[model samples]
Target chain A: MKVDIVVDARYKSCPGPLLALAEAVMKASPGQIIMLLATDPGAPRDIREWALNVGHKVLNIEKADETYQIYLEVSS
Target chain B: MSKISIIVASEKLDKLLPAATLATTAAVMGWESEMFFTFWGLLALKRDYEPKEVSSDYKVYEDYLRRAVSSGAMPSWLEILEQGKKTGRLKVYACSATMSFLGVKTEDLVEYVDGVVGAASFLSKAKDSDINLFIS
Candidate 1:
């Protein structure tokens, strides 16, 4: 699904993308979807675990040219 | 959000970096994290602390390690901790006994240090954490 916020964490390392996503989640309203684009090899697992722990819904994590796009819907 | 509490008890850079890195991850994940710096670990939190002891424990790779860190390829542990603090989910504390022994006052610590906490208080915080770690 299309998202409201797109976090560009393309070249950043571990925790950077996650941090940016966390900040975006705090500012985003419930029912909005957000996407995080990250290149770190650890980002996918981090995103999955973080979303699990924080009660967010993970839509999918797709790969595009060595970068990953993690999508999540804000849980109300 | 989950909770992570770390007890840092080593002076070595290798040992300290992981603790800070994990704390950063926990913070970024929107978890509440508390770090207790005790004994040797307290040195890293000092206002004037410098990482001059690079590779001290890894003598064989001392030159390589120093170059990697000094060249800005790797950020210092303290820098990682500071980034974690920006999430407002990370809190750092100095061990009270260490503070008294080292003659370090509250003002002598970096701004990220929430305060000085004794073992009992620290244990209480750790007790409620979903993930408790001891890094040395």
Candidate 2:
């Protein structure tokens, strides 16, 4: 299965949405591809590193203007 | 596993505790977590502040933050979040603009932060995240 998750991190308050997404992905079945969208500059490297540390693959990273597109493949 | 971004913008201990708790909880559940401390939230990562007593309703928050720290107790707000970075797959970033506004040198921040960056950089990086949060 494939899912596209958009995390609007542009606000200066609230971290619940991001945490929810991570929990959802962790509970998802294997072989799922999740595309995450974030606006925080730290999202790319931070997410990439987290995926790597927890046995997920960061498939692609693309940037357009002020947005980021991160693709992940669940391996576990 | 996927990407999660938690953005903190408030400097108040009360307001910041929720975001920290959520991030640490996600990490404990085996999910990869990243907390981006921006604006006033970056102040909580400063090395000099001590943990203050919160209201009774906030005891859970205090407890959670305490547990997330290294000494099995909250050393301070700064220490609590720092421990989250160490014990879990958590990465913390200080907002570049905020740092400059607050006259926060890189050396002034606690050791848990991964780097200092502007909003543009943070937005570009977080664009592909699975989850994004903004905590006040």
Candidate 3:
């Protein structure tokens, strides 16, 4: 099953929420898809680097107005 | 898959903020994160003693509290936990042994705590975690 979470990170700049989302997705066993919704302008670049470092797949990223949607697939 | 478990052991307000910040960061990275507060750290979960304007760096305890309140940060320990909870990725657990030693009940803890758990329980849950952090 796919786990989808929407994070409203507009008020905070720290990478905490994005890190948490990635961890949650990884714990969902292998081959699970995690969809993260974030409004933070820095999320895309930060999350991209984080995913690469952790060996997760950054499937796609889509921008919708002021928010961004990131889809990540757990590869390990 | 990444999972992290954090153990908080200090009651000092300043120390707790850094730990909470790290926990929030772990959660944001898509990790299943759990924080176990024990010993002095339990004091930080109390409902009273909100720090309003705390200085990020303090040479003394009083200065820390004064700056915390002046900065309009957290004036009470409970408020700090509330701010962490609002991030929505953290699970806060109070140590059961500490509560018993202090003769405190679970209801006496701040509302943000998930439950009162023991060290064994916490360790078991953390066995599979990719990262384990201890904040003292």
Candidate 4:
């Protein structure tokens, strides 16, 4: 719930949102929380899959006004 | 780590977009990703060359694709490839035969190209890949 970084990738399509999050994750300390805001329809699933592959934790996903708010926790 | 090997055979924007997307995605996912640009695909590696056109049948939607990139909805194919490269997990190879056929020298290629390789060399490197894709 304590978000340390916010990555705004709304209106960016596939790879954009994920790439932004990946970049943030690289700079994040272990246990830091990053919230990604993305408008692309595929962002949620893409983020989930990417987190799984990269060993991050997806805290939660919420949808509002056609945008997705994805919460992630950085891993060591 | 899993590995994905892609053989790119076209210079068209549409073909290159998907190929780049897949290769980059695989790299970011901690997989070993390699792309061999052969035939027309090799043109995309040429210095200062940008593939603006789609395949003939998709000409009508070329503008649509361009707009998406311009409007910031989609990243350019090269941008995607560059992101993957930043992770140090992706390898890009230009086809040696195509270079000779197209009269492209090593200096003609963009700096990101890892090397120029022949079919046998690429195949031997790609043989253990978990996934293989031919994108044209």
Candidate 5:
């Protein structure tokens, strides 16, 4: 429920949303929660796949209107 | 770690976009990503060179793609590639043969190119990759 960082990548397509989140994660400490606001339809799946590969955790994903609010936990 | 090797053979916007997208995505995903720019693709590595047009076959959709980038919906191909390089998991290589044929010197290439290599050398590096793709 508490968010440590907010990454807004709305309307950016494909890798844009994912890249923004990846960059933010790199700068965050372990266990910090990052909320990514993206409008790209593929962002949720892309983030999940990226998290799976890089050992991050997706806490939750919620859609409001056309935007997706994806919560992620940075991993050590 | 997973590894992806890509052979890029065109300089057109459409070709470069997909190639860069995949390579950068792989790198962002923490995979080892390498791209070999051959023939026309090597032209794209020239310093300050910007791909201005999609392949002629896709002319009808050229404006559509351009609009996406200009409107900020999609990042430019080079921007994507640069992000991938920053991850330290991506390697960009220029083709030795193409350089010779096109008279392109090492100095003519952008600073990120890791090396100029022949087919055999690139193949050796790519042989162990988990995914391999040739994009034109």
Candidate 6:
């Protein structure tokens, strides 16, 4: 789907994308999808884990080469 | 919610790295994370907290660690902590007594430090935490 907000965390450090995601996700309302494009190999797992821990839901994640494309929905 | 409190009492880069790693992870996991820098650790919170490989009990690993860090194999402990603070619920605290003894002021500390606290306050927070770690 077309997400209005895209956070490009490509080449960012570990946990950096998580923080970016946290910050970006807050800008959108519940039900809005936020896309995170990250190059950090560990960011997918970090995002998944953090999403679960915070009660947010990750709709899907796609891996293209070494980069991670994650789609997350903000939970109210 | 669970909480994790780390007492950083050393100046070693290795110790501080793991402490920051764990603190950030805890916070990202929806757990409150607190870091108390005391004694030797407080030295690292200074405004000029440069990353260096300091020799600890692990003397044999010093050269290897230093080389690896210089070669980009590792980020400085301060770098790790900065990343943690950017995205996590991590709070960094400097020890009041240590600051007094060292004549360090809040302005002398890194800008990220959440606050300066004493042992009693640190203890109170630690007591309520789910995990407490003493890294020295």
| Candidate 3 local lDDT, residue B103 | 78
Residues B23-43, model 6: lDDT tens digits: 877776778899999999999
What TM-score does chain B of candidate 6 reach?
Answer: 0.90
* Per-prediction DockQ: 0.34, 0.04, 0.14, 0.84, 0.89, 0.23
Runs with alpha carbons beyond 4 Å of true place in candidate 6: B52-89, B111-114
Q: Write the per-residue lDDT of candidate 2 for residues B1-136, one digit (tens) a residue.
A: 6667888877666666667766665564456777778876887778876545444566767655545443422233443355456555777889988888889899988777788887888887778878899877
Task: Write the residue-wise lDDT of candidate 4 on B5-98 in tens digits.
Answer: 9999999999999999999999999999999999999999999988789999989999999999889899999999999999999999999999
Q: Which residue ranges in model 2 land beyond 4 Å of their true spot? A: A1-76, B51-80
| Predicted structure 1, TM vs. truth | 0.80
Q: Among all windows of ten consecutive residues in candidate 4 chain A, which has the lowest summed lDDT?
A: A14-23
Question: Which interface RMSD values do the candidates have, in the order shown?
Answer: 3.2, 9.1, 6.1, 0.8, 0.6, 3.9
TM-score of each: 0.80, 0.52, 0.58, 0.98, 0.98, 0.76
State the lDDT at A19 in candidate 1.
68
- Residue-wise C-alpha lDDT for candidate 3, range B1-136, written one tens digit per residue: 5778889988766666667766765555555778998997787677664433333355456674555445543333343344446657679999999988877787777787888889899999889988899987
Please provide, for model 2 over A1-76, each residue's C-alpha lDDT reduced to its tens digit, 9 standing for 90 to 100.
Answer: 3565444433212233234346557566677777776665766776766676567888887888877777777786
- Docking tier of model 3: it is incorrect
C-alpha positional error of residue B120 in candidate 2 after TM-score superposition, expressed in Å: 2.0
Per-residue lDDT for B73-100 in model 1, tens only? 4556766777789888899989999989
Error of 6 at A63 (Å): 1.7
Q: Predicted candidate 6: what Cα RMSD to the true structure?
A: 3.7
Tens digits of per-residue lDDT, candidate 5, A1-76, equal 9999999999899989998999899899999999999999999998998999999999999999999999999999
Q: Name the candidate, 2 or 5, with the larger TM-score value.
A: 5
Put the candidates in DockQ order, highest first: 5, 4, 1, 6, 3, 2
**lDDT score at residue B51, model 1, on the 0-100 scale:** 58
**Model 4 clashing residue pairs (backbone):** none
